[model samples]
Target: MSSVAARLAAWWHSGSRWPAVLLDAALIAVAGADLWFNRMPGNWWDDAVLVAGVLALAARRRFPLAVFIATLPMPLLMGQSAASLIALFTVACSTRNRWLLSACALVYAALTIAPWWGGSDILSESAWPVWGVYSLAPAGAAVLLGQLVQTKAELSRRLEEISEVREHEQALATQKVLAQERAHLAREMHDVVSHQVSLIAVRAGALQVSTEEAASKEAADTIRTLAARTLDELRYMVSVLRAGGGAGNGLAPQPTLDQLGELVDNAGMGAELEKGPLPELSPPVQRAIYRTVQEALTNARKHAPGAAVGVQLTQDDGAVLAEVVNTAPKRPAVPLPSAKHGLIGLKQRAELLGGAFEAGPTNTGGWRVALRVPLKSMS
Candidate 1:
C-alpha cells in the first residue's frame, strides 16, 4: 500500500502540470453531472459551492494547507464533493504538518455527519449513522493513503543517501589499501634490491682495480657506475613511496634532457644518438623519457648483444618524442635474468601524463621502442 501510494504521489508531483489540470477538470465534470442528474429543487447555491471547491483543488499542491481550509466549507454547502476529499489527501501527502492534517481530518468527519444534523430527508433518522459511515469511509481512506505515500517517499530518499555514502566510503578504503601496498613494495625493493646492487658495485670496483687487461677494467668500471646509479634511483623511489607521493630529501634529483648523452655513452653498447632541439619538460616527464631509453638499451644488451643501436630524441609541434632501435644480434645473446616490468612501467608512466608508447619489431628485423609525450600536459 505504501509503495503504491508513493508511486501515485511521485506521478502527481512530476513536473508536468497537465495531470493536475486534468484531475481538476474531471472533478469539475463530476460535480456538474451530480448537479444536473440529481438536481435538488431547493439549495441552488450548491452549484456555485461545488464549482468553487473543485477549482480550488488546482492549487492544492502549492498551497495544500490553505486549499484544505478553503475547501472545508464545501461539504456543508454541497453535501460532499470529490474535490474536498482530494484537497485533504494532498495536504496530508505533501507536508509533515501532523497538526494541520489532524485538523483537516476532524473537519472532514464533521462535514460527513453534517447532513444528518441538518435534518436532510436523504436518509431516515434511524439510518443516518450508517449513511455517515458510508460518507466518511472514502475520506478516511484518502488520508491514510496520503500518509503512507509520504512515509514511503521519505524512506526512499534516506536509503538513496545512505547508498551514496557507503559507495564513497568503499572507494576511499580501496584507495588506502592501494597506497599501503605501494609503500610496502617500495620498502622491500629498497631493503633487498638496493643492498644487492650496492654489493655488485663494490665487487665491480674491486675488479676494476685488480684486472690487468684494459678491456676488463673498462667493463668493471662500467658495471660499477651503472650499479651506483641504480641504487640512487631506488632510493628516490623508496622516498617517494614513503612520503605518499611528495618531494622528499632522500629523493635524488632526477635526470633531465642534459643527461641523455652520458646515459647512452655509459650503456657500453655501440649506439648512435640522434639529436634535435628538445622542449623544456617537467622533472617527471624527463624521468620517464630517460627510463624509456635506459630500458631499451638494457633490452638490447641482454637480448641482442653486439646489435647496432640508435637512440633519438626530438621535439616537434608541442610534443617530445623518443625512439630507440636495435638491429638483430651479431652474436649469441647472454641469457640475462629479467623481471620484464621495464617496458610495462615505461608505458604506464607515459600514459599517466596523457602520452603514448609503442614497442615492437621493425620491418628490418630490428626491435624499436618509441614514446610520444605531450609537453603541455607534462608541464
Candidate 2:
C-alpha cells in the first residue's frame, strides 16, 4: 500500500500524462451522471449533445479552446455543467492571455445563464445578484485555481535549475583545490624524493663497477635493492595522488636536522659539515634546511665531481642560516640530466616559511647555495 501511494505521488509530481487523463475521466463521469438524472424526457438530441460535451474533455489539454466551444452547447441547454467548467479551467492553466481569459469567462457565464433567461417573468422570479453569482462564481474559481497551479509549477522548475547550478559550481571548486594540492605533491616527489633516490642509484652503480671486494659488492647490491623498493612505494603513492583516491597513508618520515650528518656522509663525494648548537625549530623549517642541504649536495656532485663541499649552519638574532660552498672540481665532472627547477623549488619552499634561498657561481669557478629562515613564523 505504501509503495502504491509512492508511485501515485510520483505520477502526480512528474510530467506524466496519467494524471490529466484521469482528471478528464472523472469530469466525464460527473457530467454523464448529471445528464442521466436530469435529461429532458423524449429528447434524444439533448442527450446526444451532453454525451458529446463529456467526450470532448479527453482532448481538453491539447485543445482547450476547442473543447470549451464543444461543451458550450451543454451550458446553453442545461444552465451548468462540470464539462464546461473543466474546459475553461484547462484553458486558464495552459495560457496567459488576459483578454482571451476574460472573453472565455464572459461567454461561459452568459451561456450558463441563458436557460434561466428564456422564461416569461424570469427577471421577477430570480434576483439579478443571484443569477450573477450563479453564472460567475464557478467560472471565476476555476480560472483562479488554474492560475495558482501554473505559477507553482513554474516556481518549482526554477528552484530545480538553481539547485543544479549550485551543485555544478561546488564540483568545480573541489576540483580546483585538489588540482593545486596534486601540483604541490608532484613538485615535492620530483625535487626531493626522486633526487635522493637517484643519488642512491648513482652511488650503487659506481660501487658495483669499481669495487672487487665480495662484501663491498654485496653492500652495493643491498643499496640498489633498497633504492628499488623506495621507488616502488613512491610509484604507488604518486598513482594514488593522481587518481585522487586513497586513504591517507602517512608518508615516510620527513627529513630533519638529525639526518644531516648521515646525509653528508653518504653523499658519495667529499663534503664537510660545520655547525654550532642547533636551535629547536618547527618541522617545516627543519625540513627546509635539510632539503636545501640535500639539493646543494646534489648540484656539487653533478657539476663538480671530486670537489670538496662545505656545509655550515648558524643561528643569530632569531634566524637560522645555512650555507653550502664547493671548490672547483679537481677532475672533470660526470654529466647528469637536469630539470633546472631545483633552485627555483628551494626558493619557493623557503619563501613559504618566510625565508629566502640563493644559488650562484663563485668567483673561483666554484658554486654556492645558501638559505636563511626567520624564526618569527614559529613564534
Candidate 3:
C-alpha cells in the first residue's frame, strides 16, 4: 500500500493530476446522489448546507480536519451524513493524533443521534438506546477502514526501503569479490612470475660479463635490459592490483607517444620511425596509438623475422593516424606459439574511442596495421 501510494504521489508530482481529479469527481457524485434523495422539499437552508458539505469534500485531502468539521453540519442539520462520513475517513487517514480522532468521531456520532435524542417521546422512548448504538457503528467503521489503509501503506514503504538497501549491499559484495581476485592475481605475478624474470636478468648479466664473443655479449645485454624493464612494469602492476586501483598508487605515467621513440630503438627487430608534427592528443588516444605500433612491431618480430618495420604517425583532417607496415620476411620465419589476441585487443580499443583499426596483408606480401580515430585535442 505504501509503495502504491508513493508511486501515485510520484505520478502526481510528475504532472498527472487526473487520478485525484477523477476521485474527487466520484466522491462528489456519490454524495450528491444521496443528497438528491434525502433532500427535504421547501427546506432551502437544509439543502444548501448539504450542497456546501458535498462540494467541500474536494479539499478533504489537504484540509482533513477543517473539511471534517465543515461536514458535521450536513449530518446534524439536514440528516445528510454521506459527505461527513467521507470526511471522517479522510481525517483518519491523514491525522495521526489518536485523541483528536476519537474526539472528532464522538462529535460526529453525537450529532447523528441528536435528531433521535431530540425527537418526540424524548426520554420515554426505549428505541433511543438502539439508535445511539447504531450511530456509533458508522463513525467507528470509517475510522477503522482508514487506519487499515494507513497501515498497509506504511508497510509497503518500509519494504521498498529494505529492497534498496539490499541492492546496495549486493553491489558492495560483488566489488569485494573482484578485489579479492585481483589481489590473488597480483600475488601470483609477484611471487612466481617476477621471481623467474629476476633470475633471467641475473643470468644474462653474468653471461654478458663472462662472454668473449661480441654478438653473445650484445644478446646478453639486450636480454638483461628487457628483463629489468619488464620487472619494473610488473612491480607497478602488482602495486596497482593490491591497492584496488592505480589512481592513488603513486604509479609511473602510462606509455604514450613520447615513449614511442625509445620503443622503436629497443624493438630488437629493424624498425624505422616517420612521425610528423602533430597536435597534442588526449591520453587515451595517445595510449592507443602507441600500443597499436608496439603490437604491430611485436607481430613483425615474431612472424616475419628479419622484416623491416616502418611506423608512421600523422594527423589528417582533425584525425590522428598511426600505421605500422612491415616488408616481407627476408628469411625463413621461426615457429612460435601465438594466440593473436593482441590484434583483437587493439581493434576493441580503437572502437571504444569511436575509431577504426585495420590490419591485413599489403600487396607486397607484407603485413600492415593502421588506426584512424577522430577526436578533439586540448589546446
Candidate 4:
C-alpha cells in the first residue's frame, strides 16, 4: 500500500505533457459538442474559432505569446471569450517581451468591441454603449491582470539572478581562504622538516670527523639511529599536515613543555636558558614555544656561528611570554637566505592561535624574536 502511494505521489509531481495534452483534448471535445448542440444565430465559423483558440493555450509554456496571438484572432473572428483573456495573462507572465505585451493589450481591446460595434451578429442588436461596456470591461480587466503578472515574474527573475551572483561570490571567497591556508600549512611543514635535517647534517658531519675508535663507532650508530627516527618524524608530520586524505601514517605523540630543553640542546647553538617558573599552558602553546626557540637557534648557528643565544620563557599575569635573543654577527648583516617566507609563516602561525610575534634586530646590536600567546586560545 505504501509503495503504491509513493508511486502515485511521484506521478502527480512529475511534469509530463501527455496528461495535460490528454486533458486539453477532452476539454476541446466537450466544448465542440456543446457548440454543435446549441445552434445559436452565430456563424459556422464560431465552432472553429472556439476550439482552435483554447487548444493553443495547451502550448503556452513553450510559446506563450503565440498562444495569445492565436486567441486574439478568434476574438476578432467570433467575438470575445473568457478563455482568451486567460491566455493573454499566460503570455504576459511567461514571455519576457514588453512590446509584445503592449501589442496584445491593444489587440484585445479592439477585438472585444469590434464585432458588437459593426458586425451583423446577434450582438449587434444590443445597445452600442451597453455591448461595448460588457465586452471591453472584461478585456480591460484581463490586460490589467496580465500587467501585474508580468511585473511579478520580472521581479522573481531578477531575484534569482542576484542569488546566483551572491553564491558565486561566496564560493570565490571560500576558495581564496582555502588557498591561503594550504600555503601556510606548507610553510610550517617546510620549517619543521628543514630544522630537523639541519641538525642531522651537523651531527652526522661531526661524527665522521671524530678520531677515537669506540666514540666514533658510537657516534656513527647514533647517526644511523637518528636518521631512521627523522624519517618516522617526517611521515608523522605529513600525516598531521594532510589531516584526512594523504599518507596514512599512524598518530605520533606531540612534544610538550618537558621537551623544550631537549630541542634547544639538539640545535647545538649553545643557547642559554632562563625561565621564571612558568604556569601551565596548552599543548599547542608549548609546541609554538618549542618551534620558536628551535627556529631562532637554527638562525643563530647558520648566520651568527659561535654567537651566544639566550632563550627565556615566563608567565606574566594571564599571558605566556617567550623570547630568543642572539648577539649580532661580527660580519655586516646580509638578508637571511630564504624566500622571505620564514617570518611571514611565523606571523601567520602566531596570529592563527591568537598570539603576537615580533622579530628583528634591536638598536642595542642583536637580533631578537619575542612572542606572547594567550592561554584562553587553547580553551
Candidate 5:
C-alpha cells in the first residue's frame, strides 16, 4: 500500500498540466452559462474574471511567477470570488519563487481590504469579519505551499546525484571483476604452454648430447634452442598474468638467480657480467629479478644491436640487487619493439614482492634497468 501511494504521488507531481487545463475549461463553460442564461446575481464581468483565472493555470509550471501575477487583478476587478482564492493557492503550491508568491499575497491582501472602504459586493454589512477571514486564509496557505515546492525540488536534485554516483560505482566494480577473470584465464594458459615447452627443451638437449651422427646432433641442438626460446616466451606470459592479478604463485620453474648468465649468453649479445652470491629469496622476488634482467637484455639487443652490454648482481645484508646497463647504439635504429607492457609488468612484479624497479636512460646516453629484491635472512 505504501509503495502504491508513493508511485501515485510521484505521478501526480510530474504529470503535465494539460489535463488540469481541460477540467478548468469545463468549469468556466458552466460558470458562463449560469451567469448568462439564469440571470445570476453576478455580472458577466465576474464570469469573464473566472475564465481568466482558469486559463492562467495552464502556464503555471512554465512561468509560475507570471501565473501568480496574472491572477492579481481578479480579486479587485470581480471582488474576491472563491475561484480567485483557489488560483492563488495553486500558484504558490506549484512554484518555488518565494518573492513572487509573497508579492502576490501582499497585493491580494490590500485589495481584500479595499472593499471595506469602498462599496463592493465582496464585503457585506453583515459579513465584514468573513471578508478578512477569507483573505488571510489563502495568503497563509500560499506561503506554506511555496515552501513545500522548494523542499520537493531540492529532494529531486539530491536523488539524481545519488543515482549517478551509484551507476559509476557499479561500472567500476564490473571492470574489476572482468580484469580478475582475464588474469585467471591467462594463468591457466601459462601453465599448459610453459610445462610443454620445458619438457621438449629438456628432451631435445638430452638427444643432442647422446647422438653419434653429426647431422642428427646439429638438428637436435637447433630443436633444443628453439624450445628454450619458446619456454622463455611462456614464462613472460605467466609473469604478466601473475602481475595482473596481484597473485605471484601462478607457476613453478620460473627463471631465477641461477639462470642470469644463461639469459645474457642465450640472447647472443656477447654481454659482459659481474656476479655475487644469491641469497635464498622468495619465489616471487627471484622471478621479478629474472624478468627485469631478461627484458633489459632483450631491449638492448633489439634497440642497440652490436653494442656492448653489462649486467651486475650483488647480495647485501637485506636485499638482492641487479643492474643491466647497455652501451648506446651508434646509429639511429628502429625504436625497440614496445609492447608498452613489459616495463609495466616488471614494475608490478617488483611491487608485488615488496621490492622496487627502476628503468630509464643513464646520463651517459645508454639505457639502464635496476631493481632490488628483499632477501631471506641467511641465519
Candidate 6:
C-alpha cells in the first residue's frame, strides 16, 4: 500500500496532472455506480455532498488540511466516500506537522464511527461494540502507509545529496595529491640537479680562466654560461612548485621582460629579441613568459645546435604574446637526453592562466613555439 502511494505521489510530482485527474474521475464514477446498482435511496443532498468531496480532492496536495476538512461532512451524509480516504491519505503524506496529522486522523475516525453510533440500520447492534476499532483501522493504515512513503522519499533525496558531495570531495582529494607530487618533483630538481649543474659551472669557469687554447676556453665559457642559466630556470621552477612559499635565502627575484636581452646573449647562439611596450603583468604571467623563452632556447641548444633563434614578446588587446622560432641547425644536432615535458609544462601553464599555447614544425623546416596569456590581474 505504501509503495502504491509512493508511485502515485511520484506521478503527481512529475507534472502530469491528467493521470491523477483521471483516477479521481474513475473513483467518483465507481462511487456513483455503486449507489445506482445497490438501489440506495439517493437524495440530491447526498449526491451534492459526494460530488463536492470528490472535487475537493483535486487540490489535496496543495491544501491538504483544507481539502480534508471540506470532505468531513460528506461521510455523515453519504456513508464513506473514496474521495475522503484519498484526501486523508494525501494530508498524512504531505504534512510533517504532527499535531495537524493527529487532529486530522481523529476527525476522520470520529466521522467513520458516527453513522454506527447514531443507530443506523447498516449493521447489527452486536457490531456496535467494535465500531471505534473498525472506524479507526483504515484511517490508521492510511496514515502509516503515507508516513512510510514520505520517509522513503526523504531518504532517497538525502542519499543523492550525499553521493554528489562525496564525488566533489574525491575530485578535490585527487587535485591535492597531484599538487603534492609536483612539489616533490620540484624539490628533487633543486636539491640534486641544480647542485651538480652549479658544480660543473664552477669547474668550467676555473678551466675557462686557466686554459690557453682558444677552442677549449670557448667550450668552457659556453658550459659555464649554460649552467648558470639552467640554475636560474631551476629556481623559477621551484618557486612555481612552492606556490607562494618563500624561495629561501640568496635566491634572486624571478626573471621578467627586462631580462630578455641577457637571456638571448647567454644562449651563445645568435638569437634576436623583438618587442614593443610591454603591458604591466602579474608575477605568474611574467614568470610564464620568461620560462617559455628559456625552455625554447634550451630545446634549440639541445636538438639544433648553432640554430639562429628569435624570441619575440608583445602585448595586444588584453593579452601578452610570446613566440620563439629557431632556424634549422647550422651544425650537426647533438643527441641529448630529453624528459620531453617542457612543452607540456608550458601548455599547462598557459591554459591555467586562461590562455593558449601551440608548438609545431614551421613551414621552413624549423620549429616554432608560441604562447598567448591573458593579462588580467590575479586577485
Tens-place lDDT per residue, model 2, 95-136, is 888888888888999988787785664576567778888889
Per-model root-mean-square deviation over C-alphas: 22.7, 25.9, 23.3, 23.9, 21.7, 21.5
lDDT of 2: 0.80
Question: Each model's TM-score?
Answer: 0.51, 0.51, 0.58, 0.46, 0.43, 0.54
| Candidate 3 residue-wise lDDT, 169-212, digit = tens | 45445655666688899999999999999999999999999999
Alpha-carbon shift of residue 51 in model 6 (angstroms): 1.2
Q: Top lDDT: which candidate number? A: 3
272-299: candidate 1 lDDT, tens digit per residue: 8998887567877888888799879877
User: What local distance difference test score does each model get?
Assistant: 0.76, 0.80, 0.81, 0.67, 0.68, 0.75
Candidate 2 residue spans exceeding 4 A from truth: 1-22, 37-43, 116-130, 158-184, 205-218, 221-240, 243-379
**Among all candidates shown, the one with the greatest TM-score:** 3
**Stretches > 4 Å off in candidate 3:** 1-15, 41-43, 120-125, 243-379
Could you tell me the lDDT of residue 38 within candidate 6?
36
| Distance from true location, Cα of 48 in model 6, Å | 2.9
Q: Candidate 5 at residue 326, lDDT?
A: 90
Off by over 4 Å in 4: 1-40, 118-137, 147-175, 221-379
lDDT of 4 by residue, 291-338 (tens): 677667766665565467888998766788889999866533323334
Candidate 5 weakest lDDT stretch, 10 residues: 243-252
Cα RMSD, model 3: 23.3
Best to worst by lDDT, what's the order? 3, 2, 1, 6, 5, 4
The candidate, 1 or 6, that scores higher on lDDT is: 1
1-379 per-residue lDDT for model 5 (tens digits) = 9999997677666777755666566645653443345332467776675567656656665666676666665556544544445556666766667787777777787775664555565546666667767777768676686577667866775465456435534543564465578677777777676778888889989999999999999999999999988877777776666454322334445576778778888866669779977756765676677778877886776667557899998986588888999988754444322444557767877777777889999888889998887764222
Cα deviation of 90 in candidate 6 (Å)? Answer: 1.3
